[model samples]
Each structure stands twice: as C-alpha cells, then as structure tokens.
Target: MAPQVDITVFPGNIVNNEFAATTTTRHAINPSTGEALPEVPVSTKDDVDVAVAHARTAFKTWSKVPFAERARLLLAFANAIEENREQLERLLVLEQGKPLGLAKMEFDMGIQWLRTFATMEVKDEVLDDNEDRIITQTFPPLGVCCGIVPWNWPVLLGLGKIGPALITGNTIIIKPSPFTPYCDLKLGEIGMKIFPEGVLQVLSGGDDLGPMLTEHPGIDKISFTGSSDTGKLVMQSCSKTLKRVTLELGGNDPAIICEDADFSVTVPKVATMAFLNSGQICMLVKRVYVHESIYDKFRDAIVEFTKTVVKTGDGFEDGVLVGPLQNSMQYEKVKDMYADIKHQGYKMALEGHAMTNSKGFFITPSIIDNPPEDSRIVVEEPFGPVIPLLKWSDEDDVIERANSLKMGLGASVWSKDLDRADRMARELSAGSVWINSHFDVAPNVPFGGHKWSGIGSEWGMTGLKGYCNSRSIWKWKKVM
Candidate 1:
C-alpha cells in the first residue's frame, strides 16, 4: 500500500506581519494520486505590494542592525528550520514527488547553506602595504529583495537565494512556484518566529504575482532560479526598472566517456546521475558522449543499470527508485521526446514503459544508442528520464563539440588517468566540472554557469556579491 500523505493549507503572507488568522483556501494536489492534499490560499498583486511595503519599511532598521545581530538572527532562522525538517521533508515529498530520503537530505543541505552564509564575514582592509594607508570594501544589503524559486527543490533553492540575501541584511519577499507553495509558506512561518516581522515573507500564486514583485521599484534586487526561457522573461521585466538581477537557468549537461575510461565505472555513475530526481535536476547529466570503441558496451551497461536502479511507481512507495513525472505536461514531454528520438533512427536500447494500473505520471528510464550530434534529444534538454548517447573519438574533437552548446552549466569526465580527466574538466566550457561524479553541490563552493546555463553564482561569498553593490572605499593619506 502506498503511504498516506496529507497536507494542511496555511495562508500565504503578502506582508510579513504577525499571523493573526488563516483566511484563504486552495488545494495542492499530490500528482501521484491526483488528489488535493490541502488547500493553500493564493496571493495576488495587492498581497505582494503589502509584503514589499512591510519589507521596505523594515529595511530601514533591518539594514542598520549590526551585522552581528543580523547574523545571529540568521542562525536562529536556521535552527527553527532544522527543528521541523522532518515535517518539511514530508510536505516536500508530497508536493515534489522526490524520494523521502532525498527530500530530507535536501532540507539538511538547505539548512547548511543558511548556517554557512550567516557566518560569512565581509571585511575591509588596507589595499597597499603602506603603513599609513587604509582601504575597505564593506558589504551592505540591496534593501528589499524578491526571491523567485522553482518548484523542483523549493526549500533548497529558496535558501540558496534567501540565505545570502538575508545575512547580507536585505529583507526578502519570496514568490514560490505554485506547484509547491505549501513548504515555502510553512518555512516563512518558521522564519517569522526568529526574524522580526517583515524580514521574510512568502507569496503564493500562479504566474500572476511575478510582475508586481519584479517590477516594483521597492524591490532592490531579484534572485531567480528556473528555466532559461523564464530567466529571459524575468530579465526583460526587471530591465524596465533596471533592478539588479541574478539568474540560475537551465542546463543540458554533457558527460564525455573517453575511450580509455573504464566502462564499469563511468556507465553506472552516469546512469544514476542522469536519472537522479527523475532527471528533474538542471545539472543532471542530460547527454552522454562515448568513444565509438566503447559505445556498444557503455550503452548495454547503462541500459541494464537504469532498468534495475529506476522503478516505475507512485512516489509514495517505500522502495520506488523513481516516481511519477510530477505533472502531466512533463509526462507527455518525456514520452514525446523518447518517441521522437527513436523515429530519428536512434536505437531505443530501452523503451519507456508507462504504468498499466495507475493514473500517476510514471515513465521508465530510456536509453538511445548512437544518436546524432544534432538530434533534437541531444541538442535539447529532455529534463526527464531519457538519456541519448552520442559517439566521439578524438578528445580535442569531442571537447570542441561539447563546447558547441550555448548552455555551459556543467560537465563531467570519466577516465582512469586522473591527470588527463582533470585537464579535460578544466578545458570543458562549463562553470562546474566533475571528475567521476555528478550533481555534487556544496554551500561554500560557488555554483553557476558561463553561457546560457545561468547569469551569476547563487551561494558562497561570491553569491553574496549578487545581493550587494560593491563599492571600493579609499581614504587619501597626507604625508606631512
């Protein structure tokens, strides 16, 4: 029997004020069963205005609070979230359809970001070795920021934006994706307990409330994470106001399995990384490039491994390796891509199979053999359980080919020669390079892309730069 998960709707807050009452109703459906778990109230533009107004007023004082005080409150917020992580994890599993363990791990990592960023010290010092000279670059918040996060990993992504923004002394208004707004709202409530009213807020709705949040002059900066298409739209929207923006966009990450690479090692790791989170992760290995010598063996190994590792079932099951697609649109898209690739003459080493007795959006992991370099599935990101293999022999040739894509988010190299793999990783045109690993993220380490993969970094001291305006201060010293 599938686990029974229930959601309780909490009213979305436009303004971060004391919660007097819950006065709205909307339901978030569990995509696996197609049942509404709980009804969460949707916020409108007026709500966003109210939220921003409160934050704008709060910024006057919040920004003045000593950096130490702000850091203290940030740690407090992290503590509150940590205490209720299991409850948050349960809700995340219900709405997002990721495995329960993965959800919990994500929550933990999100808290780690909060803790790490809270203690980050921005210092000012002398620029020269001169004994009588001084220079400083003090960090200051960008007033009120609007954080727009996607539904895939709402808690973690939201923290990636909010953690830096908040610790830097900026008040925040988060507009969470409608697909999973409950967790955002609940997290906001927990934040309010530690933070002063208006320091943090959550607004929930479809796409309607985005314009007001981004275009509002009161919002000093915007941090967003989602598709490149959406990132473009947001960039245009924020342009008119000329607001500061940070965007973490889409990725079609490619893994190059070299001729000298061990198939036994690369095949299994790439297969798991490709389909982790049901291939919903932006950095998930979307395409695999193998040398022709090992293509056949790599294909067979990946196909066999994917079959055993990924399970087709509702998300609520205990041992389900992969859950439903989280929505019907994604389900159709994955299925369509699989069919298209097969029709384009690529062999379907593994065909995607839908569930026979369930209404949930489940699809089997699929592998396409020797797909053309320019094939639709190879060029485009499926963002689903589909892996299309491409063949390449010359290292120089393949590196040139891999760098061809406009999306330079991430890449991975697999080989027994660590030095060779490291060199390739450095040469790959990507913001992040992994040797023998994929989907590895840490809070202290910066993450972003060079080309269309993203606009700016999202975590670490570098990420804090996005939420701040850098000013170099110098005092002219007179030698009398």
Candidate 2:
C-alpha cells in the first residue's frame, strides 16, 4: 500500500508559491513502511512556470552581483546546511530509506561541495599579451537553470547543482524526484527565506513537472542526474530551445580483480560495493571481472560477506545493513533482472526479494554469478545490487570487457601490485577510477563519465563551468 501524504491549508508561501495551481498537498511516504509523512504540496505545471519565471526575473539582479558577494551568500547557505544537518538528515532518511549514518554522510558530502565551490575563485587570465595586442576571458552564469535531481542521493546531487549554479550567479528552479519530494520542498522553503524569492525555487510533484521545467523557454540550462534513458528524454525536451545541458546518467561500473589480487580482501569489499543502498547507485559495482584462479574463493567469500552485512528493516535502525527499494517499480526491476539472468543459466550465490507484509518495498542482497557476457544482467545497468562475475584471462581482455557497455560512469581496479593497478586504471574507461577502493568520492575533485556516462563534469572547478558560459574579450592594440 502506498503511504498517504496529508495536504491541508498552510495559507502562505508554501501555498501561494505553488503558483496558485492546486490547494491540495500530497503525502510523502516512508518507502520502508508505506506510512504517511508530513505532507508537501504537489506542484502543478503553473507552479513550475512560476518558479522558472521567478528564477529568470531573479537572474537580472543576481547576475549583476559581484562574484565575491555571490560566493559569500553560498557560503552562508552552506553554513546553514551544516547547522541544520540533524533535521535535514532525518528528513532524508524518512523519505529516501538510506541508512541513517549513510544519509547523514550524504548530507555532509554535499555540504562539503557547497563550501568548496563557494570559496573557489575564478582567476582572470590574459589570452594574449603581445606588445601589439591583448585579450581576456571571463566565465559568466547562464541566466536560469533547471536542475533535475535523482532520488538516490537527493541532497548531495541537489546541492551539487544548486551550489555551483548559485555561486556562479544563476538563479535556479530545482525539480526534485517525485519518489522523494519533501526534503527538497523543505529545502526550498528554508532557502527562499535565506536567499531572495527568485534566487532559488523548488518544484515538487509528478513526472510532468520535469518535462515542463526542462522544456520551458525561460530556462537557460538543464542539469540532470538520473538514468540514461530518462536523460535522453530530458535532452530531447531541451532540444527545441537548445538549452545547455549536463547529464550524469546510468553506469554499469566494473570492478577488476587481477590474478594476484587477494580474494579475502577484495571479495568482502566488492559485496559492500555491489549491495550498498540495495544496489541503487549508478556507480555500484554491477559487474566484476575476476581472474579464474581465485574465482571460487572470491565467490564464496562474497556470499558470506553479503550474508553478514545485510539486515533488513527500516532505515533508522542501528546495525541495519539493507533498506527498502525506493519504490515498487525499482523493486520489480531488480526481481526481473534476477529472473532474466537465472534463465540464462547463471548461478546465484544470493538472490534478492522483498519481505512479505512490509510497508516499504525491499530486496535481499543478491549475487548473480557468471552469466553469459551477452546476458541482460551483464549487459544492462541493473541499478539493483545484484553483481554478475565475468572471468577474464588478462588485463587487456578485462579492460575490453569492462568498456564494452554503452555506459561508462565509473570503474575500479583491485590488485595488490601498484604498478598493475595503476596500469589497469589508466586503461579503464570511466569518469572516476578507484584502485582497490569502490565508493569513495570527494567534493574537491571532478566526477562524470566518458562515452555515455555523462555530458559534463560535476564537483570542483569543472562543475562550476557547467553552469557558466565563457565570453572572450578582445582589445586590439591596432584595429584591423
């Protein structure tokens, strides 16, 4: 059963700012319990239009603010996020079902990014400085951006887009995933109080709202993080207006364990990487390329490790290893993938399934072993935590197999030899490569993908670039 969200008369910005389209508030549920949460307004297309209009209007004044002042405001926003971390963290856990600790970590990770981008300064450079002529360049914000954030790490991705966009002086309308909207709506309410009305706005509701915002002519850019299929839809919607777009799409990231690698160490880590968040992350190790020599040992260790780590329950419980799948569709997809691979004669070391009579959609930790290289389980990005092991003979062969996918968001190499690991890291096609490590990310570094993983980088200085357009200035000492 879906949880009910209460919509009552609030009679203020939460209502009026909803663009006066609908008065009814919708319930956000705990995916784990199917229980109603404090309701947030479900926005209408009119609300989306109003949010974009407000952002466009705000851009006029916001774009003129000195870079330093803009940075200061972002810093203030970051501080506020840090101060309210506890409240925000709980809200995220309630809606998203990420373990409480992991939820808190995700929140802080985004805060780190906000702080980093806020303090970062764009240094001016003279393009040409010959005695006869000189030229320069400056990076400036695109007027109004529509940020489409995924539900996986809501706050982290939301902050990733909002922090850079605002610090660079672009007013933005954020469209939170309908699966989880309360946190973003709450974020908007607080953000509006901190910044001006038009500086930042949040749109919460059904799928139609995303298309409306992305396709709106007033939007100058679209920053989206979600599945590749949906990313295509977003790009198509933005095509008519030719809005600048940056997409961080799906990934079927591979982890390579060379012959010399220790199965004892790598297996346990791989299980965590594969199953964490119940396998919802784009960069989760969906495919494993292991040498034949240690295959059995590696497989057994991973099964054991998975059994130890996964404890099914609500996300708030301490020592809980796994939580409910974000929604039923995702839950069904994971099961379908499991069945598809099973039909291909792959042996399952572990299989995922939802608990009976449960409020939230759930799946057990699963390990699908040695499916045909061409099987959907191996070829498609199973955003669920089921890992398919593919054995390879050499480094070149492993690299070839890993890069065979249409996606290339992230990958990692696990080997004891530093030289070999680094060599393989250089060969893997990914935006970020982890050597003997799976999921560590930093706000100060750049992350995105090659091929179809994504269109532009996010985080660090590169992330800021996605929100801006470069303007070249030429001062000819002698005019032609």
Candidate 3:
C-alpha cells in the first residue's frame, strides 16, 4: 500500500534537517487549470546564510566519512523515495504539468541515478612507483555545492546534481525552480531522515534566491540547469568567485531523416521526441530535417501520426498525453511565436488542434512544414510543442545547417544503413548523438553540451570529477 502522504500539503525550506518557515510566501499555480494550489515558502538571504553555514559545518564530517558508509546512506535515501513514490508522482504532475506516467518515470530514473552514483568510486591515479620516489593523484571534494534545478524534470535533474556532489563527498543545497518546488522540497524532507544534518538541504524562493546562492562566497561550486541566456549569467557570476560550475543549458537539436530511412518507424519516433512533455525538454528534437526525396511522405506521415496518437488535456484526464505549458510566461512566449509564424507567412503542415477559450496555459501541437532554414521556428528553440520540418536535398548542406546553431546539446539521425547513419551522426556537433533513436540518456553516460549549450558535464565519471579538485602527491622514499 502507498504511504498516506498528502499531495496538497505545501512544504517549507529544509535547512539543518528541519523545516524552516519564511516571512514571505508565494502560491504555486496549477498549470492544468491555472488555479493557485498552495503557498510555498520564499527563502530570504538569512535563510541562505544559515543554510550555507550549516553546510560548511557539516562538510567537516561528511567529507571524512567512509565512502562505503556514504553509499549505504544514499541507498537508504533511494529506498525512502521509493516508499513515497506515489505521492511524489502526483505532486510532480500537479506542479510540473507532466503526465503522471512521465512523473513516475522521472522518479524511477532519479532513484536509479542515486544507486549508480553510490557504486562509483574515484580512485587515486599512480604516476610513478619507484624505490626513490612515488607520485600519485587524488580528487578531493569541493567544500559546498549549490545545485540550481530547473522546473523541467525536476526530480531527475535535481538528483543528477545531488547524487554526484554527495557521492564525491560534497554537501549540496538545492534551489528548485519556484514554478515547481513542491516535490523537491519534499525530497529534501525525505533526505533529512537518512543523511546527517546540513549534508543535504533545499531552499525554495523566487528570482532573488538564485543570485544569492550563485554569488555567495560560501558556495564552492554551482551546478546550474536552465536556459542559455541564464547560463551565461551564472558563468559570469561564478567567475567573480572562481567557483567550479557545471551548466546544462538550452538546445535547438535537429533530427535528420535519411532518404533510406524507414518512414513507418522513424516518423513516430521523431514525433514522440518532438512532442513529448509538450517539447519542454532542453535536449528535445526541435527541428526535423528530411531529405527532399522523401520529405513529403515523411511530413504527411508525421502529421497523421500526431493527429491520431497525440492527446492534449489535463494530465489527470484519461488519455491526455500532453499537458499545459508549466507556466504562463512560457505560454505567452509560444503564443508570440505563433503570431510570428503567421506574420512570416509560413505554412503549418499539421496544426494539431486550435487554441480554445481555456483557462490554463494550453497549446495544441503544431508542425511547420518546410519552413526556411533561417525562420524563427527553425532557428530559435520554441521549447514548446511546436516543431519545424525542413527539406534537405544534400547531405553536406543538411549537416552544415544542423551544425550552424550555437546550441549543440543533442541530435539524432535516422537511417536503415548503419554505416550511413553512423557517419552522419559523427558530423553533428552535439554532446549526445544517436542514430535511429532520439533522447536516449542514461545515468552512466557523461552528458554535457558543446559550444554555447553548456560548460561542464552532468553524469558519469566526468560529472563526478566536476565536483572535486585534483591534487598530486609526490613522496620521497629515501631521505635526501
């Protein structure tokens, strides 16, 4: 039986293994109905200072604890999350505007990530082992980490940063997006039962809290996941203190469908990536490039598939695969893009459904058919359920166009010929490239971005290294 956790109960900041209330509070809106849910506490500068001081104090012992013991505690934390999975899933759907099914997937993946990070160990590298002298290198954890998690996939991304930082012996204070902070706060509450006081904490606030944490001297490192523009600001802020930073920013990813691609299989896969989670994912496929030879067939097939298969409504309603945009700001931005699409006289191949006189920030999925390469929908990432399908007659030209963007987070190629697909995938300048698949991510893979996409890695060994400092030790065996 599921735990009787109240899905409607709003939580405050988790600092020093306790719930800390704030003088100011804000209401979290339900994206499904545009109704206010409950009051979420907004942390102040004092809260940050207190949290940081506690973390610094806790780091003294947490960093010295045996790695095996840390692993055991992390596993216990994962188990606690599993026990309250149903409550977390419902909270995620209500706050993040994703289907309950996707929320469950996110929670499951988050648990798996914690387990994976627990098993990983950073061993010392021996450079020399001579009789006269010995040389070795080791990784020491940074003092205190600040993980700034975005609203999209809050559970997975939050754990992505928290797992590596904690496993590598660094204490972290998570600042969840105000748009979706309930589940993360609850996560912090759950973690407090397993981890030591101040080892893992969460602070909930609005725009002001982010700058306070990022610019705070107490924070040794900042792992930020957000838009490219905001990432630039974060990098600039961290530069002032020379703090280590790992940024996983925005992406305008492209998917190239080769002439020999299997239309039946490729079309649905591409559509899923383009429309899933209402296309709010940073690494989602925002642009589709189809060879001119079969562009028409691929376009028509995707349109028909989206119309028949994709459902849009409240997440609680049965068969609703797509929910409203997580917030009103994003809803207005996508609406502006829609207006621009009309002004530019672009043809929409499949406008799934018209916008209704609804209360929530809802938008029906739409596909732009063969928009110009430089068009807004093609060049800029909508970050919504709108995708642009373009025609490409030449492989070289298509690859060039795909690589032209400054944001190279993830890309995919679809082709029956393994050699052809592999060759094309190699040419795309993205952190994660897939052939005949899209959005295939794992906890063990080192996922980051190229160019303006991001600065550091998030998962795998590279991600763990991001939270630590390298030190070389030279020992003299004989007295000199």
- Which candidate tops lDDT? 3
Ten residues in sequence with the least summed lDDT for candidate 2: 1-10
Model 3, residue 345: distance off in Å is 1.0
Candidate 1 is scored at a TM of: 0.94
RMSD per candidate (Å) reads 3.3, 3.8, 1.4
Global lDDT for candidate 3?
0.90
Model 2, residue 129: distance off in Å is 0.7
Task: Report residue 28 deviation for candidate 1 (angstroms).
Answer: 3.0
Q: Per-residue CA lDDT of candidate 1, range 1-480, in tens?
A: 111222364644535655423345566667677777776666666666777889998998888888889888888878878777777888888888888877887898998988988888665544654566667776667899999988788999988887888878889988888787878878887777678889888887776778778888889888988899989989999998899999889999989888788777787789878887788889999888898898888888888888886676665577666777777777788888877875777778888766647767777788887777888888888888888888898989989888888898899998888999999998898888999888799888889987998898988778887788877676557665
What C-alpha lDDT, on a 0 to 100 scale, does residue 287 get in candidate 2?
91
> What are the Cα lDDT values of the candidates?
0.81, 0.80, 0.90
Tens digits of per-residue lDDT for model 3, 153-202: 99999998889999999999999998999888888988888899999999
Clashing pairs in 2: 5-27, 31-360, 32-360
Sorting all predicted structures by lDDT, with the top scorer first, yields 3, 1, 2
Residue 460 in model 3: shift from native, Å?
0.4
Q: What is the lDDT of residue 11 in candidate 2?
A: 25
